[model samples]
Target: MSLAHPAHTPDMINIMIVGDSISHGSSGDWTWRYRFWKHLREHGSNIDLVGPKDTLDNIRTAEVGDDDATYADPEFDPDHDAQWGRPYLTEKDEIEAKVREHEPDYLLVLLGINDLFWYGVEPPQFEANLREFVACARRANPGLTIVLGTVLPCRKAVDDPDFGARVDACNNRLRAVAEDLDTPSSPLAVAETAAEFIATEHTWDGTHPNPNGELRIAAAFADALADRFGIGARYPRPYPDVPPVALDAKASID
Candidate 1:
């Protein structure tokens, strides 16, 4: 589990983002993943974002975009393992393969929302699936660092009396899962997404985040990375805006 060896170079860190829509991002939206990439670039960190998929969700066409969104610097790698509607169960099977393919130093997980909102997965079962997903990643590479994120509150949860409570219960179990999985060589840390992502302020439509919300999410992950792994540099606020770039006509999600 110890990565302090010749296998991993000290200069470069490979990070893989793992999640559903929140991580995949929709067309014309800058995902929290991009924000985190900008944070790394601004701080002069030698990091590479790795994944099998490199396309953004096209909310307009109800398909993958033909071109990548111009949310951050074009130089930043946009690769990640996020899918549009994938749940923990779906990701559990795919995670090991992704780990083997990307060989990332860290996996930043922001899943479970779809499981609860879309699939109606219970909190306990969701937590179990999450644990298995983590185990899959570890089995692929014991030295991999795992950062788990608490689910953000949604506007729809306010209307559904039990939804909000379910989210809270799942978050609590998420923390416990992190604590149970923490090891010196392959440590698990929980990023407080719920605190940073306010349903009213950060999200555009209660589910996905607006641009400002994306920054908050990035800040949360960046702070956790700095605090736990000592990998990221200080992120400056009022992040410079990168104008949207035109997508290629042939660009499509694979």
Candidate 2:
């Protein structure tokens, strides 16, 4: 059985977050996913968010530990293993199955960095993966709310000089995908990150974010969620920095 939630009607705001490292809060802190939940609980009058447990996989290894080692959090299991990293469609079927099993009212997806890093999947594959993701979610729960986090930016991507273009290509595809999904049939929300969130200096390794950077990611995401869901005033200051319009657009898909 799914976990229990506070009192709320069917129309009450409900949310679910799914994705890679950012959703996991890998920067040694509670990411915006949790912050948004906290904000809703503290601020929203009747919104009730539910779904999988925290998305963090603190342990990089897949070791099966003692009873305590059991992944009580449905979002992640100690036994759950990644067959392939980045651009993880290689494991897309598995991830989708897990999310469907959870059956969240609102589904938020934050992924693609690993795929870009691992397979360097071009724009076409990126769109395919996203389409498949949305289709599967809608298939499992017809009325489910779907939110897409634009594949965020990475300074490391600019290191190659050609990397910027690739990132743009990916982001462009994300924008188009978001637009396509936001139809009356599915009620998709595109959590635009490029213009609202992204700190070049805050990045940990040009890819992953440090604590503050994670907050930025969380904030932008929170803002989008609030705007889309019709929740009250701005939830904790969303990543304060808006992305520069002139972010170098030169990287190429290697």
Candidate 3:
């Protein structure tokens, strides 16, 4: 559908991140959102991270969200629309309204793993809901560029055949969904999460990403933005640390 995007200046691009718990993140987690935020700022982009929620959920505690921004580094803008345990089926309306309200230039969407794990949504049906979500967003803002994150393999997938199959199938259909829903005005791309992320090592739990996983996922989004959308510099390294190199004159010259 050819929808009208909200008017905005080229000087500043507003972005909103929408997803489930992985993107919402709990206390003490350095979410990939933050990492990508850091990447954009490091590259000197005039961007505004916009959302309705900015609270961290303590998943371990019975109280889900404490309304505290307890990230490892509490510097970047923490605005986001992600909530813990939100069903993929219900996000269409909310996203549409939010898109119209916020009028962001890009939507970084990472969802559906919760649906696969908890709701056991089949690939076809999952794709259908995802398509609807995309249509909803595009209907709100036609110029909005979207990027989808694939379902990373979790610890439960190792032992449970059904869950593993569901994960694999959902991801495959996610790619197809990106291709099918993508348009010239609102291009869609899939973040290279499945190929680059090793959930076993990267995740603190079976599903959620740990620090290392956060960087990988962030890199996946960053690379897609650079390659597909021409947004920012390529993700420099998987880890934050850079080894200091002392090069000899000959080697340095060469």
lDDT for each residue of candidate 3 in 1-254, tens digit (9 for 90 to 100): 11112244578778898988888887777688888888987897767788888767765456655555656777777888898887678897689999988778889888887788778789898989888999999999888899998887788877788888988988899899899888897899999777767767777767787777788888888888889977887898637642221122102111
- Candidates by lDDT, descending order: 1, 3, 2
Model 1 clash tally, residue pairs? 1
The TM-score of candidate 2 is: 0.73
Candidate 3 segments whose C-alpha is farther than 4 A from its true place: 1-9, 238-254
Report the C-alpha lDDT of model 1 over 1-254, residue by residue, as the tens digit.
22111134578888899988888887666678877887776787777788887767766564543345644343456888888888897889889988998899999999988899888999889889988999999999998899988898889777787999999999999999999989999999988877756778677677887777787778878888988878775456665554333344224545
Candidate 2 local lDDT, 1-254, one digit each (tens) = 22335555776655566666555543133445544555555664454444444334433344312112222223211111111233447545654565566656676667787777767777789889878877777777778777777777777565665666777787788778778778776687777655544546656556555555655665666677678766554556434553321212111223
Name the 10 consecutive residues with the lowest summed lDDT in model 3.
245-254
Winner of 1 and 2 under lDDT: 1
Candidate 1 Cα misplacement greater than 4 A, ranges: 1-10, 64-73, 234-254
Clashes of each: 1, 11, 0
What lDDT score belongs to each candidate, Candidate 1 first? 0.79, 0.57, 0.79
